[model samples]
Target: MLPSVTFLAKFSPAHRRTITASAIHLTPWQPSSPQAEHASLSMMADKCKSMDQLKQIHAQMIVTSRIHDTFAASRLLNFCALSASGDLNYALKLLEHTPMPNLFMWNTVIIAQASSSSPFEGLLLYADMRRRGVVPGKHTFPFVLKACSNMKSVRCCEQVHAHVFKFGLDSDLHVVSGLVRGYSVSGGIGDARRVFDELGNRNLSIWTTMICGCAQNDSAEEAIRLFDGMIADGFEPNEVILCSVLSACAQSACLVLGEQIHEYIEEKGMELDVILGTALVNMLLRTDHWLKQNSAFMD
Candidate 1:
């Protein structure tokens, strides 16, 4: 296994997940290209434990004129932008200084910005990328849309959705999921459902996204309807979807369906963590109140 990510605390949990996943694909510096000193230095940036070591490597690359190699420059940019101890400002400066920043460099910085506290900056960066005539690939939209989701900007969500279709990335599941979330959070449930339905094939995650979107938007009937559809499609509901549907049931006072879901949870031996447990309790409370009212009125 690769070295433990010692600098994890410096980033948000989202960025930490991005870094951890990248570690598997990131190879150590290859020293075999003896004639290409820059290749060896680029590898060092991947293994850089701290900013000081990274700076030392950067200085060496500049002194050797290896900074001109876009690939070499990208390694330094990646470390600064995404690594825990490294600096985002420095990474931004490096990209600004580079004459031609590649797609990977754009993605690294965008991901960092998307998960950062100031996610709006991510949207600005994406706009700058487009202004520079850089066409975004599949990896780009998710982060861009994430920034939109964080800001809860309905206009921004619609704008991003336009780009998704313009680039023919509307079918990409990750990007689609981001759209569902962005639209949902911004109170654009109709748009969210439209996007969800347009997809020819949907995954469990997309289904969950649509259901949660409906539930959160006060479309309890739609949320419960979708949940039943999901089951018919052979998708097993996970904890998140269950919680969302339970919220829907609570809103609609769906006593029979709510009880059925509770039984299903028990049958599946699902753990009742805080979120799931709270959703369950809320559903029961609401339904029970309805029951008591109906019984009292009958008398």
Candidate 2:
């Protein structure tokens, strides 16, 4: 499960200062009691809001006997690889010594590599996984597809899409979303739209993805049309969707539409925080001259 915003808010200025001081004073290797070990692992998992904390936990784990604990070790490896600075080398070293890693273990490492600076390393690991005869699961394709998206390797994405169908993950939301995103990023909007259309029930995230794809492809008209469709379908627009719509309006210099959106935002009592406010200001500035000229002509 994803961490709640409120839970993440706990890592505020005071907490970060305290954690940093504690990390500096902490002894890397110390003999730990069972209760202490359990507490340490729990804290490591919970307070992993920064790379500093992650490193501190990793160092503590190495110093203590809990380093060999499979569950703790796997979680540590995952946090390190995925969230903690994308340190693939360190993650690989830790995983190499883990005894009889399960599919989750492989999936975690592969995902880390896929999202890492060296994405080709992920492809290499996938090849190695096939050679080791570990059959890939549904969970495996999303990360690989993500890598293909990042690489913009259309051929590679197509191959993965085919494999997803073979593995019966064609109906899986996550796998299908990844395929759509991959094709979209690889300049295959038609393919992406086809994949999106096939989904039995379109979720908000899927709609947002399609909107973003259209926007990125310079199809602002299509993006605006889709946004209208989303509203008609009764999906309340979130900040992300609003931002995309604002961007499309700004690009098209549609001052009337932009003002209408601003009014909608105001009516909904949406917070005009920094980002949204900035976009609004930019759009108004860009179109203000036209508004002024029209008013003068009318006068």
Tens digit per residue, CA lDDT, model 1, 169-279: 999999999999999998999999999999999999999999999999999999999999999999999999999998999999887898788879878878878788778
Query: How far is each candidate from the true structure, as Cα RMSD in Å?
Result: 10.0, 9.9
lDDT of each: 0.82, 0.73
Angstrom error of the Cα, residue 161, model 1: value is 1.5
Clashes of 1: 1
Q: Which numbered prediction scores highest in TM-score against the true structure?
A: 1
Write candidate 2's Cα lDDT for 117-215 as tens digits. 777777777777777787788889888887888888878888888888887999888788888888889888888888988888888988898888877
Q: Candidate 1: where is the Cα deviation over 4 Å?
A: 1-36, 287-299
Give the range of the ten consecutive residues with the poorest summed lDDT in model 1: 1-10
Q: Which residue pairs show backbone clashes in model 2?
A: none
Q: What TM-score should be assigned to candidate 2?
A: 0.71
For candidate 1, what is the lDDT? 0.82
